[model samples]
Target: MPQTLFDKLWAPHVVADLGDDWALLHVDRVLLHDMSGARALTEVGERGYSLARPDLVFATPDHAVSSAPGRSSATFAGGARPIERLRQRVRETGIRLFDLGQPGHGIVHVMAPELAIVLPGTTLVCGDSHTCTNGGVGALAFGIGASELTHVLATQTLMQRRPRTMRLTFTGTLPPGVTAKDMILAAIGQLGTAGGTGFAVEYAGEAVRALPLEARLTLCNLSIEMGAKMGFCAPDDVTFAYLKGRRFAPTGAAWDAAVAAWRTLRSDDGAVFDREVAIDAGTIAPQITWGTSPEQVAPVTANVPYPAGPADQAALDYIGLAAGQALIGTPVDWVFIGSCTNSRLSDLRDAAAVLRGRKVAPHVTAWVVPGSETVKREAEAEGLHAQFLEAGFEWREPGCALCVCVNGESVPAGKRSVSTSNRNFVGRQGTGARTHLASPAMAAAAALAGAIVDVRSY
Candidate 1:
């Protein structure tokens, strides 16, 4: 009996089959953020519903917090109203909260794996789409809507259908400047934004195996953009090693038991996937988005996509960009390299690799916000913080910061920012602000040149 990793994971969590693309699925973990708690709790109050597995639920306020370095003021347009409301909701529900300034405070996705709350073979649910980020740890994790989140909060079971499976396999080695971010962006570009709809994607091959834990998260984090409901990697020695000493991981005899359990979580030899996409790491370069959709991407030295197939005419016009024109050397107003997608400690190190001894272009406003205080501390200890500052980039505190514009942080209107954060939808960074998503290393190169320079040559 051959089973794909997706099938192996999906089988354990299935509760019932309910025709019409829905199945009763059991949840192993429920992650929530400040904004989501407000709506979910208010719904719980209105509907008189109670949490199914209250002990497994946790809350944090990272999404809307100010990443203003050492600034205490949570100043945004709402001025902490959202934060207070979320705090009130979490308190009312009696759920454990990492809170704003706590050691575990950070993007829900980044914080989960670091705490070891996301173990192999578990099913994790959250209100944020990037929850797929946890799939790096061999878990089935992804975002749900507010309504679905409320349902999960009250009922640890979800009405979800098993998705089709897609396996992304890559062999050989990645070229320098090419990263998991680029690999994922390339996957999304190849499949287009709608490629993974109603599917769970498992990454395999020599390239995927070579990636570090943080890099795998970057690959899985964007599964949503490809329209996948879940993304995961199979558990292996590398996975066990990465989890063995994490904050919330098992200890002593329990730790031994946990490791034993994790060791068995791999695809059966005959496992099957509904679909698969194979890529070569050598073919992938540092990728960057040229338009609103994550699918509108190209290699660093490549030109913007022309009207291929059916494309967004308006989006192509909005940036005032044309097909076949190179993005390299195009002047950029800002460069941001922080987000759940690329704000981890390793991400900073990668950026610092390119930023060392090189100054940011005078015309570019550069910012680097660590994903968590833990990441911040580690970066500073390693002097990566000093490297960023010396390169003229703002070495700021940890939080969602400009990634969500949930805080006061925002790019001025009409400014084009080369950001490492996920999603470059229209005005996603701010009102009328334009964003281009790329890997952190590519971001550092762009910051140095103050434009969209191809990193293949950097």
Candidate 2:
């Protein structure tokens, strides 16, 4: 029988088939962060259970850590308790932890791949929906709930239903200034947020195959935004090269063996999917969200959509948008170019290229938070920090700054921010604050103009 990439990665891990599409799938890696990790660990501890495979589990403090310069865990009001609890539990459980000020400290999704904690043909889970980001390296990754986390901790496996498979193939080349962020946003716009429900999506075709590893990571990072269980790109030489010499990646003979096995981790030539969609990458423009949901997106030149239904009208109201209002040139109060979705070095370089020799608008509060300390140091080496500082953008310490609003970082009430973060539910930034999602370049342009102008115009 022909096997898809998902099949190749999922089959070996299936320990039991419990009928009706359910199976017990072995979890190869388990990642936890401070926001939810502490509670889950405490629950298991209170129940008097020990981790089945402590060596396979890892924890980090990201969600509740302050991104303020020279920040301590206590920097954010209400942050210290969860962080301290996580430290105590991780110490008791014996799982490796990447705590604050550590090189491996970052958003769990960002740290997993860069540190090679996730690898090709593995099953990874975190108590984070964006754990799909690790799928970029060909891992089968998903977010599990607290109960499921406890289950994985005790059994090292999850009882799960098999998701139907979908393949979204992208053909043609993306135009300059259009990026992987644009491509995924365009798909969400076209397909609606629930379009990929009940499926695992594999991105393929010429454009996906051609994407650099970083871009591939960005593409997979948004799979959950579209309601998919996970999304992944097949691991090729590009994936192998990116993982080489990483802190946790295999070395020497182990590296050679790993690459050889990864080569066979793709779909067989004749394998079929339950559903498939093809996209013309050339047609995608720099995209931005106009409403609360990620699917309420349009190209930079587009207007806020007039309501097609009551739901659409409700979305417009929540976002403080008037029907048919033009989004381009609309004023924004802030600009943020950081998140687990787009705070990598490549994302920073692209935004910095636009910010060089330019100044931010006087009224716009702009910030750039790197995804990890390692990414921050590397960007500094390349002088990207100077470019942002000279342009009046606050360069923040690496963490989930302004993305999840968990650590006292937030947009002021009633202010609209153009942000590179994923998700823009009403008050996602703060009470009464509105968020407009965009690529790093688009966010940078908004910072410069104090308005949502087209990045191409810059």
Candidate 3:
């Protein structure tokens, strides 16, 4: 009778068992963005289907909006149509949209948590893969395809196969300069990208519990890179503290009641998982992706690995790195610090600590884009933005800048960039661009050194 955290969150939302390990699960929260939300909404409207719960759906314009200062929806010509269409569709559907320049507007994943639109024990779905980022607060969140987005919009429910449960427990103490980004990166390198296929992973153990809520979100944001659609950490005091007094979170007596119920959102002691993996926190160092895949990673002190096969060789060729080459001292042309993966206020603080009195190298173009307007305002309030600008980093407006490269921001072709974004896939930042994934601090260090260097040394 024991239930895992995923089971506890999932069972209550089951509207029906659709058989074949699939179920019709009620969706408590739905997020939409300009890139796909407009199309999905248009589809539903054309079909004459009404939204089952328009109030539960929140839309934003992160994907197609420019992050440049004084930017407007029209700033990115390629994305202007989708932004306009999303604005029009949301008006027709009566869905609440956090429009550009609005207080609540931001990247769907970032603003959702910042505004407390996602909460413990809820089921959230977004059109983007990093929707799993909301799971840090204990939500059963996942991404949906175009059809699935329309289905959820029409019925406020989705048909999904049950995923096996896996627990990744981080034991021991995190080494100096190690971070949640490093922790997850090390796990992916150890287990490979396909390690968590068909499973919903729950992060636990000492190190995971000790992570700040924002860091926990960063940890969960990369779950998709490991082939898992869903990942989460159980609700604890840390989770509760993070949600208190937020815009969408409960208030007064309702807040007290919500906390009481949320306390039971953990897995039962006797609960069984399909698989469990233990990672030593002490063994993990600052991690950087060496190749196209998130799994192609090594510690900052490590060298480019010898190719194990053609796949490895091909990755090396694409990244323009030779086997046995040292990752340290590799020339970096650009440094970007932002993304749903690591763009919260705390992430900015981490990078600022490294760039406080240092200037960026003359040849390295560096940028620091906050994840949301709220984060941008808060960082500015604390003077973090000034420090970055003083250190030769561009203080960019928020919206996935340089991460997806769809909003008029990208590393130029053939440039090498040290980025804090989640994935380092070929051309992820721009055509023929090579991306090295690292923590915000690591990216800052690269910006200062004009090359990949160990953050601990910086």
Question: Candidates' lDDT values, in order?
Answer: 0.85, 0.91, 0.93
- List model 1 lDDT by residue over 1-458, tens digit each: 77788766777887887878677889989998876867787797789987777678877777667777666535554647767877787778787778766788878888899888898989999988889999999999989999998888888888987788888888789998799999999999999889999889999988998999989999999888888868888878888888888888889999899778777777777678888789999889889998888998888888877776445666776566777888897788899999899999999999999965999999899999998778888899999999999999998877787777877789889888999988888878988888889999889999999999877677
Off by over 4 Å in 1: 17-21, 77-79, 309-312
Query: Which of candidates 1 and 2 reaches a greater lDDT?
Result: 2
What tens digits encode model 3's per-residue C-alpha lDDT throughout 1-458? 99999999999999999999899999999999988899999988788898889999999999867888889999999999998999898888888998877888888899999999999999999989999999999999999899999999999999989999999999998988889999999999988899988899999999999999999999999999999999999989999999999999999999999999999999899899999999989999999999999999999899999999898898899899999989999999999999999899999999999986999999999999898889999999999999999999999888988899888778999899999998899899999999999999999999999999999988
Error of 3 at 207 (Å): 0.3
Evaluate residue 440 in candidate 3 and report its C-alpha lDDT on the 0 to 100 scale.
95
TM for candidate 2 is: 0.98
Better of 2 and 3 by lDDT: 3
TM-score of every prediction relative to native: 0.96, 0.98, 0.99
Look at candidate 2 and give me any clashing residue pairs: none
Candidate 2, residues 1-458: lDDT per residue as tens digits? 88999999888999999899899999999999998798888988788888899999999888877888899889986889989899999989889998877888888888899899999999999999999988999999999899999999988999999999999999999999998999999999988899899999999988898888888989998999999979999999999999999999999999999999999999998898999899999999999999888998999888887889998888888778897778887899999988889999999998998876999999999999999888888999999999999999998888898988989888998899999988988888888888999999999999999999999988
